[model samples]
Target: MRVQVVIIGSGPSGLLLGQLLGKAGIDTVILDRSSRAHILSRVRAGVLEEGTVHLADAAGVGARLKAEGLPHDGFSLAFDGRDHRIDLLDLTQGKRVMVYGQTELTRDLIEAREAESRLMIYEATNVMPQGFDSGTPHVTYEKDGVTHRIDCDFIAGCDGFHGASRKAVPDDAIRTFEKVYPFGWLGILAEVPPVDHELIYANHPRGFALCSMRSLTRSRYYIQCALDEQIEAWSDDRFWDELRRRLPAHHAEAMVTGPSFEKSIAPLRSFVAEPMRFGRLFLVGDAAHIVPPTGAKGLNLAASDVHYLASGLIEHYEDRSNAGIDGYSHKALARVWKAVRFSWWMTSMLHRFPGTGAFDQKIQEAELDYLTHSRAAETVLAENYVGLPY
Candidate 1:
């Protein structure tokens, strides 16, 4: 295979990058080791910040999104049986988020690519990126016991946290910053309407409960638990009982109980590797950084990276300037750090303390109370939650 850009992984980042590049007349090829198109259909993130919505439209993949995505002006924060709404649109001057799943977004991008000439390689192997200055980078992969090499002008590593691309970088050049939280999210996908008009993030002695959604008929929810929690230990009845205690509403049991499609422990962590570019290869999305899911910033962050990547690549092509490539790392990190802080804040405020004195929980509640009651405090939360300018 020969192309201008070779993107690894067909997840949101890789697929979206491919769509953007393809629309730009850049011959891009996406290679994924997974043999089948993703149909997991489980809901993940529903909140989209204003800046992200604008960028998504500019990238050309936002056409169907604007039409089908459910728009929300704000979301609510709940604690002590009280619900407080943070009006994002009012705070951000017309900025609003959408309720959509990462999976559907991925599917949209892939469907858009159908008319384009990009290659989608599955059951791929070998998968090593080689050569740079020679003007052609090598991507070796094997399929059905047959080995093949893909040549491209630049390679994009978007496979994500566990992919092989990160390891391909020379050890001497990689500088990593990471934080592994003591807790993990026990996420569940249930067939039920949302518990509230807006998403509710609740703090309880049991743990943190996020009231999120996939659409009008399905709910995407999560509760905090020890990182080592096992799914086998949580029976269906036990799951409903826990949810009832965490979520506050009439018929709380009905709000939680329904046909569930997924229940898994998603580890919460924040990580970033410096200098996202090496030779002719660029790492975007999860290959470059990861944030805890509390802020619903994962897909947004991934999209932002590609937005800059697309911009940088365009500038480099139009002006014959290395400015885009040179500043890529610096520009990407500014956004990364802001997201990490927001995720950390939400995580700490909602989850239970392991051994902290009562003073700590009281302090958290105080902080929460201030944010919910004070316009200035909500302005801060609204700014971060609605997104940090991109």
Candidate 2:
């Protein structure tokens, strides 16, 4: 099969990219190793920057989100047994984030793609991009014991970090930077209402905790844990108790506890691969960069990547201009690095290090103190939390 673009991965980045390009009269085939069900089943971060919501609207899948997604104006930073609110809407001149699950967003994009009868190959085995560096690029995979190939004018490596797109590049041709955090987050999802209308990020002597939600009735909570901690060791009761210990007294007292339907431990890390563009192949989302979830930048960053790549591709086809495509990496990476710094800073400020000295602890306290007392510092937090401009 031949098409204008071959997108490897049906995640939000690939699906959104395909959706935008298809609307522009560019044909794209999306390939993924996981079934549609598996992709939807995976739980991910729910925070959506304003720009991401706009991108969803542009992709024509924002109807449900518009009706159902919760819009938050501010969030609490809990420390020293108190709540310090960061007014995102006030600080950002009326910008706020949408609290909609990534799963739902992906489902919306998939349904839209299916409604348009766009080609998507799921549960394909051994999917790999071939000859992406050359003028003619194609992708290969095996489906139902039959090997197939897709020839395309451009290959989008949205297949994520573990996928074959980035691996297809010669090691010498690519440079990678990574820092795996010493701790991970133990999280749970329950059919209980959140403690507050807005999200709360808490810093405690025990560890770091985040109180987030998928909806008014569905709460998602996470607490910092050792990287080697086992998920099996945490029961619903224990998880709730530990989470309570990390938050302010008022929030802890008002919190609702219930039987959790989902539980897992995820290690935190910051990773980036240089350039983002490898000749005819363009890396998007997790394939090119990853940030610690403390700043809620993962999915939003992916959406921004789609914005750049889609604009570039559309410009190439419509205006016959290579400028956008040529500058894709440089432009995407500029925003990517800023987000990386913000996520790292958030993680450092909130999380407790294993063996830090007294000076380090004091500095963290001072930083949080300054952040809450200073409007300028709070604005910086609010601005990044809501998102930087595309």
Candidate 3:
């Protein structure tokens, strides 16, 4: 088979890229090792920046998001037994975030693609990108014991951290930077109302906790844990108790407890791969960068990557220019680094290090205090949280 572009992932980044390209009359074939059900079943971050919302709308997948996504103008930063609300709308001049699950967004994109009769190959084995660095790039994979090859003009590696896209690049050609946090986030999803209308990020004496939601009736909560913490060790009741202990008295008192339907422990890390473009192959989303969930930048970063890559590809085809493609890596990396710094800052401020001394605790407290009282500091946080321009 031959197409203009072959996308090696069905995640939000890949799907969104395909959607944008399709709208521009460019043909793309998406390939993934996982089944459609598995892709949709994976739980991911829910926060959406304004730029991401606009991209979704442009992709024609925002109808459901517009009707159902929760719009939050501010979120609470709870510390020292009280809540300090950072008015995101006011601080960022009326910009806000949308609370829509990544799973739903993927489904929306997939459905839209299917409606347009686009090609998507799922559950393909040994999917690999071949000759991306040479002229006439193509992809190869095995499906149902049959090997297949696809010739394409370009390849997009959106298959995430463990996928074959980055691995295909020569070690000497790509540079990577990574920082793994000493802790992980033990999170749970329950069918219960959220503790507050807006999200709450708490820095407690015990640990860091976050109260987020997927919708009005579904709550997503997290608390910092040791890197070696086991999911099997946490029960619903125990998880609730520990979470309550980490929040202010008011939130704890009003919190509703229930049996959790989904639970897991995810290690926190910030990772980036330099020179996102390798010849005809471009790394997008997790394939290029990763951020800690503290700042809610993970999915938004992926969307921004898609934005840059899609714009470049559209320009390459429509205007017959390679300028946008040539500048993709530099432009995307600039925004990527700023978010990395913000996520690192948020993680450092909120999380408790394993061997910190009394001075460290005091510094963290002083930093939070300053952030709450100083409008200048609040504006910085608000701007980064809502996402920088694409």
Candidate 4:
């Protein structure tokens, strides 16, 4: 079908963009392979930055978020066997982040979109990108085993990192920047109550273990591990033992254990694809870049990317200004690279190398000490964590 914009992938980026544009009276269509809409909740990214919350509110989609989300002024840094709480309100006055899961945001947007008549789609369909510069930008796929071709004025490739959008780019014009670590993180979801009110990032000889809770009753936590580490390697009993040993601020802190609901592993890597656009097709979210989970920049950055894109596309359509839309690729790269650097720094300083020498270990400890002792260092971390709008 032909439309002003044909957005591929119904995840956060595409759905949010479509919602924003549709509210503006801009016609857009969203196509995905899933037959049913799904919420992205019950996963990762417990920390939400200040800027992201504002953007959601601006789009008129923050009602559920504001009601259900928790407000946290700051987080704690654990080092030297002690807890140092950096009150974010004290650091960045008045700007607060809400603690809401990515899945919750998706569910809100999904419900909102279900009431819209303009956005159309076929879930559980196979889609591919082609024939963009040749007049009609097309997404070819099969729905219910019947072949179909979707034509549009422009294509939003929100299919994510593994989708076919990246490969559609001319190899000569693409620049791939990558930094892979020697480790990965094993994230855990437990029905147990949270160990702390705020999230904690602990740097120890063992690895960088993060202490985070989803709600008063549900908790989410992560521990650093080897690249080759298997889920079976750490049984449920062993997981709790290591968590208690590494995350406690002191002997007084109590970690009420609960049954784990889910667990999974994510390989640590920093990646970005250059030019994010090729003719009429543009990429967003994981389709364009990937970041380590250390800084909690994954979902926030994707939201930022699509926010810019939706505005740019509006400019292009309403005012006949292709420059704003054309410059989207370049504009998005600025924030992407900055987050890449911040995420890499957090990852490098916390995770342990396979053959970490004594000097390296000492340096890591020293860096942690400086982060806690130095006010400027603390401010930098707070600013990055609270998130600055790019």
The reply for model 2, stretches above 4 Å from the true place, is 357-359
- Report residue 65 deviation for candidate 2 (angstroms): 0.6
lDDT of each: 0.79, 0.94, 0.95, 0.80
Query: Which lDDT tens digits does candidate 3 get at residues 101-210?
Result: 99999999999999999999999989889899899899999999999999999999999999999999999999999999999999999999999999999988788999
Candidate 1 residues lying further than 4 Å off, grouped into runs, are: 39-43, 133-136, 249-256
- Encode model 1's per-residue lDDT on 1-390: one tens digit a residue: 688888988887788778777767778888888765443343456577666667667656788778877898998777766667789889877777888777777777677776564578876887888885356688898889998898877888998888878889988988999988888888888887877657888887677888888777788778888877899998767877787788666526447367677888888888988888888888888898888888888888888888888778767766888788778777888998888888888888888858856787778778889888888888888888777764
lDDT-based ranking, best first?
Answer: 3, 2, 4, 1
Stronger candidate by lDDT (3 vs 4): 3
Clashing residue pairs, candidate 3? none
TM-score of model 4 vs. true structure: 0.95
Candidate 2, backbone clash total: 0
lDDT of 4 by residue, 1-390 (tens): 667888888777788888888877778888876644343433657567776777677667889888878898888877658878977887776666688887778777777888766565756356788887677678887777788877788889888788777878878978998888888888888888778888888877888888887787888888888878899888777888887677655622687776688888889889999888788988898999999998889888888888788889888888989987888999898998888889989888877778998889889889888888888888887787788766
Candidate 1 at 48: error in angstroms?
2.4
